[model samples]
Target: MILDKEILAGLIEGSPYPIYLILGEELRVALANAATLKAWGKDASVIGKRFLEALPEIDGQPFEALLRQVMRTGEAYYAVNDRADLMIDGQLKTFYYTFSYQPVKDADHQVIGVVCYATDVTQLVESASNISRMGLEAVENNERLAAINEALAASNEELATTNEELTESTRLLELSEGRFRSLIQQAPFAICVIRANDLVVTELNDRYLELVGKERTQLDGKPIWDGVPEAAEVYAPVMEKVFQSGEAFFAKEAELTLIRNGLAEQVFVDFVYEPVSDLSGNVSAVMVVGIDVSEKVRTRHAVEEVEERIRLAVEAAEIGTYDLNYKTGELVGSARFDEIFGLGNGVNRETIIDHYHPDDVHLSVLAHEEARKTGRIFYEARYIPKGLPLKWLRFQAKVYFDANGNRLRTLGTVMDITVYKALQQQKDDFISIASHELKTPLTTLKASLQLLVRMRENPNTVLFPKVIDQASRSMDKITELVDDLLNVSKINQGHVGLKKNWFNLSDMLEKCCIHVRESGSHELILEGDKSLMVYADEHRIDQVVVNLVNNAVKYAPDSREIFLGIKSLGEMVKVSVRDNGPGIPADKLPHLFDRYFRADERGTQVSGLGLGLFICADIVQRHGGEIGVESEPGQGSNFYFTLPLGEKEE
Candidate 1:
């Protein structure tokens, strides 16, 4: 069954267990259920702040490091009976808890956040501590009895009085022993005592029997190894060492294999073995105390595996990561971050900021200011590296705040987007230009049709021809624009086919300029080799010549003469179209043939889709040829292309 976000949120909010979600490396508190909020002694106001900021008392604790570890490694952390100091009701109080930090992953299996599950165990810990104190009191009673025995041996006259006192003391000692045994049996953790001489189980609590998966009858008077033989190899030596040296041995999160429930299983435990001494000061037995930590140990192992995968993924993507300190202005970043900003190792925050374009720096500052409230920052701006072209970089980060609402730090990623920005600008320009170009011709066509309709009603023969001509020209303009659009689409789809054949280049060039010659404004001067033969598409070549000549006619209207030249050079033949019009600027020349680019000077308007030259370049490249232009202002311009000289067909 699927549940909506609202239902899921309600479930979390209504849950009795404390739950919260922290996002990003900064550990900003993205969500906190009611139980969690109450435990934290906070309200909804702390939702967008950094976890540490909302609970500043956790500064010296391991929570921040553990959360970050989960975030970095995609691992989960679990602890049982962990101690934490928190500010509750304006008082600093110590609390014990059983909690887990589970890594939250996105669809890509990347760790994006951490969800915390916690249970307060302070009362349970306090109850266990009281039981431990009672056991200590019983040990003290035994010592007192031993001293009393020495006092009686020193004075015979005091024996009778001492006997009375001894009777009362024995009674009290017996009572204390009973309470101690009762507390030990009901203890939350496992406890057992092994005799040092025979390594036999002299005494054990029910908790120990349950922990080892054994019956009281089987282990009560048996050797320690006889009940759980699988553990002898791993733990027997540790127990022996403690007894022989009369020193306590402590083991935390130690793995041990034991036979439980007729099966061998691995379990993790935090345990201690302390030597118990007799009245003569000789070690008589070894007392063992332990708690099962198998769940926590296994959880950490799973988290480590996830962390390995996440590390590999981050490296493969070459993503830049960074962590910034808001107060100190200190920055720590991955190698990719340094490469993106063109900075050296150990780069400071100020040095990196210097690379931001002066005009765009305000954008970053404003984004950060806004993030203080929103808990996130995202902005794209220009970056100018020393002696490098300007670049567009997208900066995304999450803001963190301290408990008092003061900015703490920000964690974020950066990516270079210069190419994407350029493409976006081109797309916008195409939309604007396409709208204007299409509208102009369509408007004229509509006006001409309206005029023709009126002329037909009035029956004016003189205006009829003019109206018909105007309509025809408008239709031709619209058709040209549509054809350019179709060609661009075809080129992008790689559907521009070529039909190759051997033909005389000069013969095609001559017929290609007929339309220009018919204009009667510009003269076509043909020059160079007239018999240069090449194997290529005849019609496509004709299209190239026509486009170049049309460009000269439209851009170089003042130039009365247009020259077409052809030359044979080794295995290739070159075709040139030269005009004595105003030349293109150096900066504009580089992008003259780019799609949707026009070379019209300021205040000068030109007609055409700006795609004629782009199409020409593509056609020439398909024929295994190169195209380029040369020009200077007022010195006119020369556009040329070269085709491979294939062997002539028989």
Candidate 2:
């Protein structure tokens, strides 16, 4: 909308409000509004001229950019008390002004020129003039009536100036309030303004509505207490206390449980209720600020529950569990685990893992690596007890992680599997004996039936003798089965009685060797003492030796050598049977003496029912001695037992 120059000049002169332009660009004036321009000394002539042409000093300033922005956007830019140096009517001046930059737009919304508005506030900067005149004017008093008139005039002028300052101050205060409201609305925290008398909410920020789980329409003009009962209940008394005492009230760890999305969730808050005061120092209202701590509260509760469950599970399962912080090298072990490992002194992340069974150390390292890489760990193995020989335990572990999937720590349990080991051995023994005993008799019976069939098919009565021979063989096999059953029964009943008597170890070994030689497949060699006396059940010791030698011949038929040795120590006689055969695997060596365990894969068909070694161990232990074996796969095996020797022989 373009306007003619004549019409624009008319509007500029007719406008009732004061307007001035002082920018880097175009400005105009028609017949100056006030002629008090010389009040600024030499810049008096500049009032009736264009601002940019009258003040050429700021030509290199950013005023040009400011002018363009206002002209193109038709938006005014304002600043209070801008400090700048200016040349007015060729006189230098230090000035401050309340000012604005505005666009003089044509009819088509095109910028014709830039206009600036400025109100000089330089009177505040001229206070030196008033202070210098104060005392000198008091000393030049003339007639009393004249002086009184002068004083009254001065007082009236002072009142007029004060009123003008107050009006300007009020406008500045309103501007400040507007800025404060903008900042509050943009804040992340909920803000509210309430009336002190009725506790009514007059205004609230957007976040305040979200926090209350309601919309502004639902909450506006409502009693603050009615709209947010939980917050109201907490702050009502607190606000009263703050108002009564004219002090702030603080509440920490205040918890509020609210239903969110149909689920109950707890929020922890820390807040302050501060009484707001009016100009007269009277409490008018209260302001509350709160911080939510719900996530921290929930995390602490979850950790507690997890730790508790871990403790109980480990205790009840007769296991020990541990946790280690990799960063700190700090270790924590459950009480049950400490008791089991006898490491009650406590253990940590760097707890000497070498103290565990040597064979299990590598497994532990592997599990640790897996946990570090994958953020999860799982492992189980047996370890010998720290202070006890032949006592072992099984341990298992898991690794926990952070939300980002980083490994946080390890959790594990240890169980006492010693009894389990013993029970497993007994089961193996029973199965081995049962399979062998049943299979041998069945094989003999089948052989006998085959012989009879042959006899029936042949036209020779002579074949009947061979059938009878097969029947006798079957009967012999059945008798052996019956003997094995009786022996197992006696051992179970603790009735395998030993006739305690002085016996020559050599004589006993010689008899055992003779019986073993009856099989005729292997050679037996005697070693060590020729004559040694042992005080034991002579018959039981003889049985033990015979079994060992027989086992050697049966298990190692391809080998020809067996070594039988008896050595007299201070109070015991040591006996051993050594054979050259495929040695036991390391894993199975510990279980060699377990019942039903055969050294080979054909366990079900192995002879002797896997019980002879177990029985030997039991009898030797009963005689106040020990028995053990040492072997490795593909290597020969050696079985050794010790028995108390007669004092005279020792």
Best model number under TM-score: 1
Runs in model 1 deviating more than 4 A are 1-319, 339-366, 382-391, 401-407, 601-603, 647-650
Q: What's the lDDT of the predicted structure labeled candidate 1? A: 0.82
lDDT of 2 by residue, 465-532 (tens): 77777777677767755666677788889888777987787877776656457756788889998877
TM-score of each: 0.54, 0.40
Collision count of model 1: 2
The C-alpha RMSD of each candidate to the native structure, in angstroms, is 10.7, 26.4
The local lDDT score (0 to 100) that residue 88 gets in candidate 1 is 88
Candidate 1 C-alpha lDDT tens digits along 1-650 = 01233445665676666878898778899889988888888889999799889999999999999999889988789887799998989998999987789888753477879988776667557756765576567667777777778879999898987787788778887887787677677778788989989989987898798788888988999998988888888788888888778998877667887777777888887777878887667899888877776764554455445555555665676667787888888787777788888877678877766788888878877898899789888899898999999989988887778779999888878888898999999888777777888888899899988887776668688877887888888898898889889999999999999999889987887777676788699999999989788999999889888888888998899999999999888999899999999988888999988988888733146787689899999999999999999999989999999999995559
Q: In terms of TM-score, how similar is model 2 to the real structure?
A: 0.40
